[model samples]
Target chain A: MTRLTRSAALGAVGMLAASAPAFAQSIDEKVNEAFANSTGWFVSFIFSPFPGTTFPWIVMWLVVAATVFTLYFGFVQFRTFGHAIRLVRGDYSDPNDAGEVSHFQALATALSGTVGLGNIAGVAVAVGIGGPGATFWMILAGLLGMASKFTECTLGVKYRNEYADGTVSGGPMYYMTKGFAERGLPGGRFLAILFSIFCILGALGGGNMFQANQAHAQLTNVVGDYPGWITGVIFAGIVFAVIVGGLKSIAKVTEKVVPIMGVMYVATAVVILIMNADMIGWAFGQIFAGAFTGLGVAGGMVGALIQGFKRAAFSNEAGVGSAAIAHSAVRTKEPITEGFVSLLEPFIDTVVICTMTALVIIITQQLIIDETTGLYMLNEAGTAIATVDGNSGVALTSAAFSSAFGWFQYVLALAVILFAFSTMISWSYYGLKAWTYLFGEGKTTELVFKVIFCIFVVIGAAASLGPVIDFSDAAIFAMAVVNIFALYFLMPIVRGELGSYLDRLQSGKIKKYN
Target chain B: MPSKIVVGFDGSESAKRALDFAVAQAKAKGAGIVIAHVLEWSPYSFLTPTELEERHKRRGEELARAETALLKPVVDSLKDSGVEVSTALKYGHIAETLASVTKAESASQIVIGRTGHSSLSSRLFGSVAGSLAQAAPVPVTIVP
Candidate 1:
């Protein structure tokens, strides 16, 4: 990690010095020039992110999938919400139960991993780029995400592997392979292999590399250049120290840190809104108008919906199956307990935090891009300023907060660094777990992957890996494609587990422990 | 000449019982004893190098002081019963560290607190004991 980080620092400095001439030219002129002469293959128009065809198809499928699964499961997520709360309280915990952390701690740990960056940075991006209607789609996406979380996490527990020494290892691999094998499905192994491959890919790029890159970027942006490799090396060192200690250490740290961060973040958002209380109504109006009216700056109503849904999907990551990896490590014998807790993730990440970010941006009147010459100039405090290196939206968000609260950029920077770092650390574990599952576990094998992961963090920070990020994002979402498909077949198993677990709850078998 | 057993206690009723089980087992088998409790420090990664070491030193001293108080009762009882006992206090990843100390001390087993998780609430949210038991590389006996 250290060696790779040093290399990254050298590379970034070289790039910065080389690009100094470009920096002095002013971002607006550069964006203007780029947009003026921009030309692409005509077929690219179909994928151009206009509202009608591109947006509706994806969102409609998601909504339909969410609706059907919700109806089929009989709104199990809602019915079991209270039960989830109790489970986290350890109301039914047995000291003798074999697991890593308390139910609450497990939820906290998983939340720490899921709830960051996505809520703050991802939400801002969605609304900033997608417009107000994006909020609606984000909410819709979150609603459907619950069903996905329920199905995947239930399987995570059910298909877990109990080692000879009594240690348990479980995830989609266990369920896809073992569950299918039980059903006499000959292709179970192949499907499971495919799922593991997807998980490893998603984990490394979206989970590990993206996270590390973002964290490094934020730290450098805030603290300025550290020995180039210093950020990556130090971050990797922290990850190694905790991961070597295994899940228990991760759980403990997450349990403590997640809550503090959540509170601080939410409170900041609320305070921002309270001060701008009058704009609350206008913001919601814009959100609804943009969502249904389709008169957004980018594309029409349809475009708004697509952007919103995509951002929400990107932020909450409900159906992606990444959260399931973290949630799978929960200690309960009942898979349903964690499933219920899993539902809360999207709510917190998308519904609450994302909404707050949208409100902050909209209430501040910063959502729209002012058109100057064929290029769109991002408005910061009524001035048309273009982003250096083309970072318009979320960085604009930081500027908005800085406008409102002096030194607020520093706060945002710190938050991003923490959020990015935590997300990267958690994703590293998730990716590594999937890696080990596919290929066998050993210290030497782990060391090799860890180095690669650390290297990607620097790459992510140093260069604009546009195609790579896009491909990785697609892969992350693509997990939903295979995952939701398998989920339809496995719904019954989840139903059965839910029934048995609920029956025990109703019978008072679990109440005595609390 | 049986090996000492390590048990973790966090002042819960179940933890007390787990402590009892470890002490009793160690006494019965004529082995030594190690009692451990993990103090969770927040945001240690963000701390400066000097601050981190200082906090570590402070925690070590605190552990040393707490160790005598926590183990005195068990040690007195075990000595009276002609059983040799030793206690240790460590920080960070209690389960893995316990597993390491279990092997280090050549202890035969580990006794851990298992608050009842079969209740209604546990069915909905979950419990940590099962994961700990599953992840630990030693035989773990959970005391409810």
Candidate 2:
């Protein structure tokens, strides 16, 4: 083991030496470009209407809405966590559950969807822009996200449709179409159709394209460019093959992949912490300082708080209603069961993994200056420079990890590939679920959507998709706008179901084993 | 004889179940059982050396108390098993710490309780048990 680790280290050092001159040249040019861009565009474009920024507006509203929804629903995220746990545990196993997968499977599937790039790149961006104080708000956002998940998942279960052959179809489309129809609300079908369109777009852009784009970038960055489109083709093929099996294959794969990857990633971060045990305190100190002191881009502490909250909400995606599409497919009679399992999504993705990424960044002394332009990038870099908040992509995290662990860049590159791949596959299903809901559940229609989704994998890799990613990400936040609104109206139903489940729990009627 | 097993205890629900299951197996097989837990040094190393040492000491004591509380129930359960039973608490890398504990005690098997849905996580790339099984030099039983 010692020999292997030593050899690995030596190989990395050799690679660093071989690549230094070329890497250094690119780095120097990038720094100059970054500084010039930041001076030219950042102040005028990003910092001026900082408060009125769409990222902030959408994020703040979602946080406020999620929090309000939680309070109005009497903190359903908490009251139902135990029930959700039981649901996953199969304590009240109802084989007759209309959903296509088990409650646990549903949670795992949703987790596979929710737990990818956002936990990694998204959190890195959050802490990078908002500073360490953002960690606190991110956690807060994750807690509130539970209520959002509960509301969406319950509505998914409540409004789900089963064909004569027992195939299931649900999500915002069904909930808005059937749910609002029952409520005598106007414009349910139109909004549902709009959401379906958005879901399809989201699956392709944020889910498939974004995941592929980042993964391709990381792999090319670390391994050097391997015909970039090669990754897309291969990735698309693998995902296409699995998704063809529908939710069953996706669930089977996710149930296994989600936990394993989740634990491994956390363990890797733990190892990094253990290796750099000395730097933990300094990391926290910097985090607190950056968060409160404010990097001084958009004004004072309030701007920093907004940045932090926005980044966390973006990272964990707790209230976005996307995860609900996945959760709606859980095979259980109880809606709250899947809801409970869904709560772990944010805890694992944001609180645990995001914190780890933040720690890696904080522990290592990497500043968020542009590698290309050498200037300090601002929060709105995505729209301004067609990148996220004017910063680099997953390289920020790779750079941070590399600063401490040396060869960590390679490992992180692999992680990015897996993270992106898994996220893309999961998001494809989310889009497909929404797709099937809008269109009838015909096999050929499903194939058409899958093909388009797969093709985006190639386009996502070949194209410089920063602007598109920003737009899709905006759409993700926008989805929260409507879904959280729906959650407010449907929160009563969630509470009632949660109460009944908790009642069973308190009565000890649900045994540990059958 | 059934395989001798070693388990870790930290008072977590999963840990307690692992200990319980480990004890029952030890009783059933008349094999040796060792329960262990780890006390990690808090990452707050920014304080003065004295203060940091004091914090570590306090945390160690607290962890010791917690582990003892967790082990007491398992110890009583194995009283009639005729299986050699011992408890250990150490500070370090969890996988390495557990592996060393397994070896030092001459135990042949390691038992760990899986977090909810953790066992099913084999399809994902980086599970704890799966990782441990790949890296560990011994057999591991994950009680789900």
Going through the candidates in the order shown, the clash numbers are 38, 25
**Predicted structure 1: lDDT:** 0.63
Predicted candidate 1 versus true structure: per-residue lDDT over A378-493, tens digit per residue: 43442222333334444656765665786777777767766666676666676776678778888888877777776655444443323334544655655666666677777788
Off by over 4 Å in 1: A1-52, A56-63, A95-100, A216-258, A369-393, B1-144
List DockQ for all candidates: 0.05, 0.02
For every candidate structure, what is the RMSD over all alpha carbons to the true structure, in angstroms?
A: 11.6, 15.7
Q: Each candidate's lDDT (Cα)?
A: 0.63, 0.65
- How is the predicted docking of candidate 1 categorized under the CAPRI scheme? incorrect
* Best candidate, DockQ: 1
RMSD of 1: 11.6
10 residues in a row with least lDDT, candidate 1 chain A: A37-46
Where in model 2 is the C-alpha error above 4 Å?
A1-55, A80-83, A91-100, A244-258, A295-303, A368-391, A508-514, B1-144
Please report the candidate that would top lDDT against the real structure. 2
